[model samples]
Target: MAGHDLDRSLGLYPTMMISMGAMIGSGIFVLPALGYKKAGPAVILAYLVAAAVVLPAALSKAEMATAMPESGGTYLYIDRALGPLFGTIAGIGAWFSLVFKSSFALVGLGAYLLLFAPISQGAVVYVALALAVLVVALNVSGTKMSGQIQAVIVTLVVAGLLAYVVNAGFVADAGRYAPFTTHGGSGIITAAAFVFVSYAGVTKIASVAEEVKDPGKNLPRAMLGSMAIMTLLYIGVVGAIIGLSDPEVLKTGGPGGTASLTPMADGAGALLGGAGVLFISVIAVVALTSMANAGVLSSSRFPLAMSRDDLLPSSLQTIDARFKTPRNAVLLTGVVLLLLIAFVPVIELAKLASAFQILVFSFENMALVAFRVADVPSYEPEFKAPGYPFVQVFGFVAGIALLTQMGTVPILGAVGIILGSALVYVAYGRPRTDRTGAIGTILRARRGEEDDGIAATEPE
Candidate 1:
C-alpha cells in the first residue's frame, strides 16, 4: 500500500474482455491439432473437461477477489490465506508462470507471422522482442489505454472465429466423427492436463481487481462470464476443426505439416480455401497480440504487490506520476519476456507455464477452504462460490491430478520453482515483512477485533 495505487478505470466489458482475451490466444489456433493428436476427435471432450476442472478454481478466485480486491491476484490471496512463506512462493510462481505464457504467445506471434512472410528465425525473435517492448510501453502509458486496445483486439478476434466456425459447420463431413477416441480414455485425460493452461485467463482477471470499477459485483461476473464464453468458443472451434479436417492430414508432421501449429488456418483452408487462410492468419496475429498485452497487464502487478510488502525491490513500487502506472515493474517484465523468447523454446515454456498454473490454482482452492473453515467475520464476499467445500475440494483434487499427467519435465520444473521460491523467502522476505495473514485475521475476528484492512469496501 505504498506509491500511487492503480487507477480504477476498467468497467464490466473491458474486464470481461481481458479475461476472455488472455484465454483465447495462440492456444486456440494451434493447440487444437496437438490436442487432436493426443485424444483424436475426443480432444473436444478434453476441452470440456479442462473447462469443467477450471470452473471451481474460477469460482474460488471470483469469491476471493471480491473479498480482497487487491493487485496481486492469486499471489495476494495465497499470501494472506497461507501466510508470508507461501505468499512469497505464490508471488514468484505467478510472475514466472504468466511470463512463460506471455513468451509462448510472443513466439506464437512470430510463427503466425511466418504464415504471411518467409521470416528467418532470428527475425522472428526480434519481432517478438519488439512486440513485447511495445506492449510494456502501452501498459506504462495507462491501464485505460491498455483496456481499450484489448477491447478492439478481442472483438476482432472473436468475430473472425465465429465466422470460421460457421463456415466450417456448413462444410464439415459427418463421417469424421467416427473413431472419436483415437488415443483412448487416458489420452483424453492427458490432453486435458496439457491444454488446461488455456483457462488461466480467468485467474488473470483477478490480478487487476483493485483497478476494477466495481469490485463486489463486477469481479465475479467478469470471471464467470469470460470462462463460460471461452469454454463455448473453444468447443465450437475445436468441433469445427475436427469435423472439417481429416485426422491423417492433421497428424502429418514436418515443415508446416502438423495442424497443431496452424489448425485455424489449415481448417479454414479446407473450408473456405486460401481466402480463409489469409483471414484467420490476420486474426491470429491480432489474437496473439491481445494475449501478450493482457499478459503484461496482469503479470507486472506481481512485482508491484511484492514490493509493497517489502519482499521485492522497492523500485518496483514506483509509479509514474503522469500516467499512474507501475513503470519499473512493467519494464522489468518486458525484459524478462525478451530473454525468455531468446533462450527457451515455446513448447517447453508452454508446458512449464501450464504446470505452474495448475499449482497456483490448487493453492487458490486451498485458500478458499482455509477461509471458509476459519469463518472470519470480516472475510465476507459479495459473491460466494456455491457448493462450498465440495466445489473447492474437487478443484484441489482435480488440479493435482492434472499436474500428475503433465509428464516429468514440467513436474520437475514445478518442484524446482517451489524450492527456489522457498530459498528466496528465507533469505530475504522473512526479515522485512510483518503483515498478519489469514489465520491471524481469523483469530483477531474471533476476539472481536477488526480484520487487516485488506477486505473489499463498498464504493462511495
Candidate 2:
C-alpha cells in the first residue's frame, strides 16, 4: 500500500449519485419534522431557501475542484489558497464532521430498522456496528464498487420518493396546506438555517474529484446537478409530509423534547395504510445506508490528502496496491465510526457536524476568493464559477449567518476544532515543509521576485 494512485472509476452518473445519496438520508427523512414544527407548511419554502444559500458554495467548490481536482476537496482548496495552517484545520474538521454525520446516519439506520421489526434497544447498537463494518468493507473493496452501490441506493430512494410525492398528491387534503405561513418569514428563515446542512453534501463529490472521470467537466456537473435534484426532492418530500399528515401528528417534541422522528412513515401510513409505512421504512434504511457508505468513502480521503502534504503521518498516504484505495485511512475512519456508534451519542454530536459543514462551506468560498485574488497562472479551471467574487462573498456571509443559528455548543465545538488543528499545524505540519500558498505567491510577486511555491499540480 505505497505507490498506486486512486483509480478513476467513477463517471458522471455514479459521481452524481454519490452526491445525491449522501444528502438524501436523515436530513430529509427525520429533520423535516423539526422544520415543520418551526414553519408549518411553510417548511417547504425553508428547504428552497436552504438550497439557495448552498448554491454559491457548490459553485465555488466546482470551480476550485476543476482547477485542482484533488482528493481533499475543501481542505485542498483552503490549503493551496490560504496556507497549510488553515488547511490542517479544514482537513481535520472536514474528516470529523463527515465521520460524525455518517455515524449519525448509521444510528438513524438502526432506529429506522427498529420500525421494521421489534428489536431490543441494545440490538440497535449491534445492528449499526454491523452495518458500519459492511460499509467499511465496501469502501475498502474499491471506489467503483462503492459508487455502484450508491447508484443503486439513490435510484431506489429517489424512485420511491417520486412515487410517494405523486401518489400523495392525489389523496392529500388541500386543507392541510392551509395556513401555510403559520410561523411567518422569521420562522421560514430559521428553518432554512436549520436545514442548510442537508445541502452540504452537494459539494462532497469534490472530495473524490481525483477519482472522477473527466473531472473538470463531471465534477461541477455532478455537484450542481445533485444540488438541484436533491433540493427539489427535499421540497417535494417535505410538502408531501405536510400535506398528508395531520398538523398535530407532524409537530415534534413528544416528551422531554424528544421529537417523534417518524413523520415520513406517518405520512406514508396516511397515503396507503400499513403497506405505505413499510415502503417508506425500507426506503429510509436504504437512504441512511447510502449516506454511511458515502461518508466512509469521502472522509477517508482527508487523511490521505493531509498525509501527502505531510500534515499527518506519511503512512496514510499509501494506497492499496490491488484496489488503489486509501486502505489505512478507510480503516481508521471506520474505527472512529464504530466507536461513535457504540459509545458516543452521535445524534447530539451531529449538531457539531452541521456547524463544521457551515464553516467548511464558508472556507470554500473564501478559498475561491483567495485564489482568484492571487491570480495564479496555474489556477485555470475548465468551468469557472459564475458571478465570481460576489457569489463567493454571499456564500461566506450566508454560511456565517447559518452558523449563528446552530447555538453555542456547536459554535464552541467548531472553534475548538479549529484551534486544536492550528496547534497540530504549528507543532507537526509547519516544521515539515515551507510550502507556501497562492497568497504567498502574491506577496512574493509584490516584492518583484519570482515565487516557486506548490502550485505545481495541473488539473486532471
Clash number by candidate, in order: 0, 0
- How do the residues 1-460 of candidate 1 rate in per-residue lDDT, one tens digit apiece? 3667778888888889878877888668767777788888899889888888888888888788777755567888888777777888888888988898888787777767777887543466677777777777888897565556767878888888998899899988888878889889889988898788888777767666667887767877787788888888888898998887767756762134433456776667765665887898899888887777778887898999988877787999999899899999998998888888888765667778888888888888988887776665667876688888999999999988988887898899889989998988888888987655666666777899776624421110
Please provide TM-scores, in order, for all candidate models, with all chains considered together.
0.86, 0.86
Report the lDDT tens digits of candidate 2 across residue range 1-460: 4445678888888888878866788788867876787787898998888887888888888778768855568888888888888889999988988988888778668767877777543456677898899999989888565455667778999999998898898888889888998889878876777677788888867656667887767877887788888888888888888888877766742222334356688668866655888899899987887678778888998999899898999998788999888899999999988997887754454567677877888888988888888888889876678888898899899888877776687789789989999999999999996767877877788898877753432322
Name the TM-score of candidate 2.
0.86
The CA root-mean-square deviation of candidate 1, after full C-alpha superposition on the true structure, stands at 4.2
Model 1: lowest-lDDT 10 consecutive positions: 451-460
Which predicted model would earn the best TM-score? Answer: 2
Instruction: After the best TM-score superposition of candidate 1, give how far the Cα of residue 329 lies from its true spot, in angstroms.
Output: 2.0
- The candidate scoring highest on lDDT is 2
Report lDDT per candidate. 0.79, 0.79
What is candidate 1's local distance difference test score? 0.79
